[model samples]
Target: MKFFIIILLFCLPTTLLAAEFKVSGYGSIVGGKVLSGQKDPAGEVEFQVDFYDYAYYDEDWAWDKESKVALQLVASINERLDATIQLVAKAADEWSPDIDWFYLTYKLNDASKIMAGRRMLPMYYFSEYMEVGFAYPWIRPPANLYWWEITQFNGLTYLYNFELGNWDFDFSAFFGKETQTKIKSHDFWRNRGGYYFPPEGVYISGTADVTWSDIMGVNLAAANDWLDIRASYFSTRYTTTSDIMFFDEIDTNGDGIADTVIERRTNPDGTPIRSGQWSLTDFDLSFYGLGGSMYFTYATVLFDYNYVTYDDGYGSRFPTFYISAVYNHDTWQPYVGISQAKLKITRDFDGFGTGEAEEHQIMTLGLRYNVMPGAALKFELNKFKDKGDRSPWYDFSYHNDATLFSVALDFIF
Candidate 1:
């Protein structure tokens, strides 16, 4: 099935060349070794299942090889429209033959363009072309800012590029739904019934409902020979799923006074009230941010900061920062950086019952060598520490004093 799709995409009509079509792919083989007494955070964490095992390790401290392969096809049908599709293969066979991107773009004019179908979110770098790691300076993009899971959305986009006086500006707005799949994992909290073992919770279950999401932003940048200044702001939000509750006051056994605690149920009478599973109330969320990058001779420097706060009374705030520099000498690029993340939990959690706040501080250093123009090799090492709550459920105390070493090869054609 995958081979057939690739063949069909390549055979599509295009006027770029009279009788030739384009096909390109790249692969990476990676290994790593590490030493630490802490448990593996990725493996034991109950909330994040797919992100675990991202680090390579041995029985005590060993290295494992991982691979990533990508193929892309582009067909220019006319002067205004072009079609593109990208397929990816990875180390996990269960998730293999993935569709990285597929979209048809129409150029409305020299300054405006519109794209439809499954596309990358235009909100951040390393998102549109993340699999091609060779284009980046780090072995992996900073985990503090880039959680690096599925940042893509299936939707429509409008982009406009223009120049005003001395500054170049580009603005984009997008609306669409995020594609999600059922995650197969064990959750002890959801299996209270003995007859059937069904998954539970929004963070753990795969059958979580879908929601409409949107992203809109603008970028303003100015550059001379020695200095460049750029700044951008992006906002994104997800619609609330049906059956989601804000805060519920429940009264059981026909009692007039409210006695039970529920996050989404409200009671007028004293009967035991259970909220149905399909009430679409308001549970909206949003994030606002500003950041920039700077480039210079021999080395490129970066400093970025962003704050995300929830709209409702839940009171969740995430403040993030990343500062790093890399020097490229045609053959080798060496880099080092420090990143910090603070997750503030204002409303006390009830179900999981962890604590109030969580914080993470990570320091990273790595180097990338250009084996060739289109291919590169990378070696990365990371050390992470958690502050505030030392609970295993919240902090990485499951993986307490954690360290990791990884190597990868990335390419583009």
Candidate 2:
């Protein structure tokens, strides 16, 4: 399906391309590696020791993780109507093409417009240009705050631009829903050594059928000469049904009963079992953010703070913030930032010896050089530290500090 779209994009008539249609593209060739980190000799734990790993870097100095190219087509359907289609190919997906945006916009007036189709969720200040690396000052946005399962939605949005006093205001409201499938793994019942009954460790893998519905969001921003301020609120109801399969289990210490009672699809005697369904239904999740940046003649100061809450009795509240200062010198820019993410988990549902809180701090120094028109080169080094309990989601065996380095060539045309 995606290949067909790519072919169709290039097969358009030359007259239309020259007259009423505009075609443009952007791309990035990014590579990074973990410079220093802890190595788990047991080989059972996978830690997010670097930004590259967090971005799914699979090889040393490879462009197959955060590298991507996107082509966009904009056409004027009428005096007040326009159509846009954006197709993206990402190295992380084996260079498979996907439709990033296919939307129609109608101008309601000089200050208002309405759009319908697939579009980015305006949940943050940079949500609209999150994937356009050339538009941001950092090699990547603050991952701890911007990370989420869903980035886009298929629905409708209304935006209005207005000015009050000396401030220019942009307000947007959107309604949408999304459905996605995700694979998750855990190693709760086994330690480093693969021991016990099955002898492969009590590792479990599962497919989660997750859906976000009743999604509603509103974003407002006001900007003037030197100050830009933005705030956003988003709420959604989510449901997930998981089908988990356990790979190994054991009866250690010669006990007649199994020490772990994980759900499985079949019994040891080859009889079918039906007890591996886990569901989180109609849970409420909300995100709130308020932050902005200050612009100066030779330097820029950026800051943002965000909070997320989940209401499934796990008592999950995530609060994160980052502050950065960038100095601009001709075509070169150097920046430094400090950020922190703290997760407060009040419910110890697993009964393990894990604590109720986890925190991570990061310090980053980077330089960006505008090599030419619509092109930039970036180099960044990051120092990361983990504090408190291990994260259950990543199966990190222990707390460790690490350093990461990355470089990328970002371009738009």
Candidate 3:
């Protein structure tokens, strides 16, 4: 995997292209800061919008949290086959580059095709182009609705496109899997919450890996001049593993006697000790989603909803949705949005594990000014509200509202 990804770094030259190859790129420079109310346990105000990346903001304005630049290349291998690759440099990673896509597509017919390789998971309406800030009116998508631990997968997809009457239709089925190491969600919830864990002799560590296998999904959609609609379903096997382990002692019998003791460590005062705990979420996961858009001469309205179910009662349901309306005025566009996610805990696992999330909502107000055909300037203000149990966004909880302001320049070349 290291060698394969390293090769992409060399293929990034786009200035000089062949007849069969074309290159294009896009970028977003976004800056944001917390306005009021959100403070950490140390009494310092801070902001963290994306749990998957763990990029953050403080009371002062900052830019590196969400800005990124990406390049894409498409090569025509033959009459029926084409190859593509995309790489991105994210500000949160100190401008380190990461590969977002590398795939090959084979045209089966004029209306059908098949693709194989790594690509973003189409779990939401904007999943395919979510990072292209120029494609959306806001600096970013609603964090509550777009949150997902796994965004990309190594997979194969069969796509068919056809027109029925005055409307065009698209249908696709995909199968793939992905394994992520040293994920952010693991450490984000590391030191939060308290539980009745094993004795203090054993060492506890945070989780490190998230594996999604046997991922299969189908998406169907139709669109006309004024309206478009979509629906999708997906299922996969989920597993999470710990990052570190320390074995202390083993009781050979039910009599609580340590037979083959690995180590004998106890409390500082020679009393019973207490330590942190760790666990994993291993289960079958299912997803259902619905989305639609309405376009008018002066305005556009979009809505998306998604529901996730963890089978075998490993956890409860996760339902998220977003609704936004944008009004267009020549080169100026203004928008407002509302989005939320509901995370529930079930007693099926004896109240042990959850999706490791909270129930929250965000209200958005933003504006976009098209500087030119391929460039835009955006400004947005978001109000974040935690509506339910604040299990752990930080090591502690902040029940009050936190307002954030952001601005961005979205461009393509």
Candidate 4:
């Protein structure tokens, strides 16, 4: 990887001389430890390192979970056209480089433009800069609100910028599609006698192909000397097809060959098991967000609220909100934030049996120190409380509360 980067750096000057090209990069080296938490009563506290899902945290000062590096190259093609390519290396994937954004921008007018190719989905105020730690006030964004299955879409976007009565509006309409594959382990079968079965856990791999049609969104914001306000609304029709494979190797019948097994869904009391996979074809999801910030000489206050709902009545209605304050003193900035989320699943569809609701709250305190011209150091402490039943996707045995401590060095060049 170092060699690859060196080669790119050496060739960048030549490219810049030939064409209007610019290169920039950002990276973060982060380490974190879980002070306390466990999923099961007898289970030991361990770090939850989920790279694909950014909500999880690292424990024991591990670097191969949250660290990442990104490089972006923008090339101007004539006066009205430009191309950008961004590559990212994440610790969760062993630092393997992946293309995050590769797009072409065509200027239609002074205030209107068109973009084509793979780009980030503008789901939140910080969506475009979510990977850049320096752009935010915390070690990371609030996980309760930022967690999503998709981050990027491959398609086209039309953006128009205009001023409306002393307020600036950035309106965008996008059409895109995305496909993702996720792999995880699950407890396939449990013994009635409370005995551990052979191969206690089975790996379940699934692929989700989603198509987004008629996706549209608008963002409006205005700022005065000390106040800023913004609101966004996005709606889309989502169609998805999924296939799952359960790697079950148990020879329950003592036969010479393994038997095909299907997943069983049970009620909260673990009775009346139903067989087969849960799948959804076409659905709709709408997102709404409102946020603002108040700035003073040395202190700032920020607050945001977001709500999401699915087309199917059985799907959960999720609402999240956060409030934070930061004080800036020279090169050091100290901040504290509180965030909460509520998940309420409407139990109307029989396809989704026995929906469970969950509630969570988190408090974070952190400090950021500008170490140098293009680098910053940060330390953060987070306390998480799970107030309700565990979400289906999360571990069933998670504790009620957990504490985490993290420190990171972020840089942009």
Candidate 5:
């Protein structure tokens, strides 16, 4: 964070000194907590949503989980070329600044453009402005549908805009790979595999790195005055690895009972040891998404759906979706939504597929008050219920049916 903050301080202002530079920023000061910990009969005390494992909540309120700030810089080098850079710092990762958007776009015509560099992957309706909390009525994006942590890629993209009768269309396609060298992958599921049995919640302090390569995808969005629709598809070669050892119970007969111990790593004397490592390489995975929104006089209705599948069956066959409705009033917005996620199938090193059709849903109620232009104050309540017997996806897997409260001050500058 210090390193990126140094760049933001020293580099952004220097770019602004150029003749065609423009600067802007956005941020969210948010706090949230788990309210129903006692209601969790098993006494698991912490909670976290998908992908953001680094940030979580417990019985006490915490601001560090989701607060963040970002600065954006745009420079028009020439009439046909432009450079954009956005640096974001998240409190959860100790204020580490991420180079979220460091891309250059070249205008081919009034309606077509091409870009190369780093940018957010267009997976959802609000992907481009995901970090700008003031843009959305809710405190954050819906967790179930927006679960993946790999939110961006470094590559080249082409975009075209056009009109077809009553609707406007945005067409975009991209091919690239993630620039992050390592990502946490296998730890979440393995810790929950031994449901209703002993030895659950295996704690292993190590890295489970996931990599995506040869990525190609397309997004198409169409909108009119009152309605909009979007669809996207992506295919990539996924690889996962870890340098540590992996351990699990043997259940070869699929009897849901441990017959023996499975070991992959050995010590110097040939004794087995590990920290939960699995190797799954060169597998093809794909994502499918669809979304629609309808605007009425007093209310807006929205739905988003996503599905992910792996051809090798080593990855999680995840499908998630959500629907929401927001009521707009004078300086006030109230919303309600339901979101769900299903892990149809996911495998571990010992053939212990923990998230085997593991399912969960969240119901949310939130209100947004416009504090002023470019700012808003929001309150939200969410009820999380796990439908599967395994556990809620978190560092600890003993809790279920948790409720959380959140408050936030969001602004743009």
Candidate 6:
């Protein structure tokens, strides 16, 4: 692996292009030991479903582990244009490969650029730097603050980044599509509460029969030494044959018949009557986020406020914030941060979904101790607070709230 990295680095053009070729990568292993409080009727039920790249559990001692590998190739293909290709693969087991990123960039200058293939969306403050492991101050970005939106898009993007005095402005326009065999609900986890699940082959709201479709959006941002700001708007149209599921309708299939109870009728004698309406109504989802960060020698403060709304007319709006302070050393750095996400369902679909809009928070404190020049060990404690209605789990006690203690070794080559 080292030899392969070295050869790839040396063979790429350097002087003529005046561009440099370099290789960088990061990997880490995290283990969690979690404990819970008296079960909260409104907290997470028994969570045993796999989420994204992490594991789930019903027991207090379940540990979550993950590993990843990546490669970045940068070439000064020419003076007016430079190119960068990044590829990453991650796994919890040796058999499967998770392709995280594969994209090519073309730069026109410091003020403008264009990119094609698969790349990160400009949705948040950390979007562009999410994978730059060494640039962040946390063991991992605050999950609560991230909202976990899918980041990669396949298509074309145009961007412009410029600076006026100390203030820097960033703007972008993008278009792309995602294809799947089964369309899954973007809010699949909303109804489930505390537990999160990886979206697989499932028709969303019974509408959008095909698993995927295309998405297009525009974003704008500006940042200075002390403050940062961003805003984005997006729209997606499903290209499936399934019936569209609305808050009041659940025609499970798009066959043009009303299979749900509310839309059905009964005769005067109480005999049931069928209604013909098996199609789901299609709608769009809109998102808006604004936030910034402040830096101090003794501490760094970051905050983000976000809002999400569905076109069907029901949605959630929330604010996620983070603040952390670090005392740097020649070889060891210790830091602590408070992260919180408070979402308000704001509005609901009359009789369709239950539970009032509420807030959820997680407090974490951790340390990073360098074991060597390129390796370090980190330990963190997370406390969770759930305030809302209750739900049942597979078999375990109700999960009102919980705490997790985790430690990991992070390294690079």
Of the two candidates 2 and 4, the one with more favorable lDDT, higher being better, is: 2
lDDT of 4 at 292: 80
Please identify model 2 stretches exceeding 4 Å from their true place: 1-19, 40-54, 183-207, 251-276, 280-282, 346-356, 389-400
Q: What's the count of clashing pairs in each model shown? A: 6, 1, 0, 1, 1, 18
lDDT of 4 by residue, 155-266 (tens): 7888888876666666777777665443221221122111111134332234344556666676676766787877888777766544333344556788856676545333
The 10-residue segment with the lowest total lDDT in model 4: 188-197
Worst 10 residues of 6 by lDDT: 195-204
* Candidate 2 lDDT score relative to the true structure: 0.71
Report the lDDT tens digits of candidate 1 across residue range 136-242.
77665566566423366676788787776666666677666563432122222121221121222122212223343555555544554544554555555543232
Q: How many clashing residue pairs, candidate 6? A: 18
* Model 5 C-alpha lDDT per residue in residues 1-413, reported as the tens digit of each score: 33534564466566556639889999999899888844444346555643633455678889988899999988887788788889999886689897778877899999999997888888877766677889877888766567665778888999999999999999999999873433443344444433213244233324455567889999999999999999999998877654444466677799998887765556678854432244444588899999888999999998888888887644667788889999988599999999887776466635645565477788999999998988999999988887755533332233367788999999999
All candidates: CA RMSD (Å): 9.0, 5.7, 7.2, 7.9, 6.1, 9.9
Query: Largest lDDT belongs to which candidate?
Result: 3
- The digit string of per-residue lDDT tens for model 6 on 298-398 reads 55666656665545533545556666666566466777777665544445555434333455566778777888887788877767675433332221112
lDDT of each: 0.56, 0.71, 0.78, 0.70, 0.75, 0.55
lDDT of 3 at 356: 43
Which candidate would rank higher by TM-score, 2 or 3? 3
Specify the highest-TM-score model's number.
3
- Tens digit per residue, CA lDDT, model 2, 219-289: 99999999999999999987765443564456777677667654565568965432234343457989898
lDDT of 6 at 78: 65
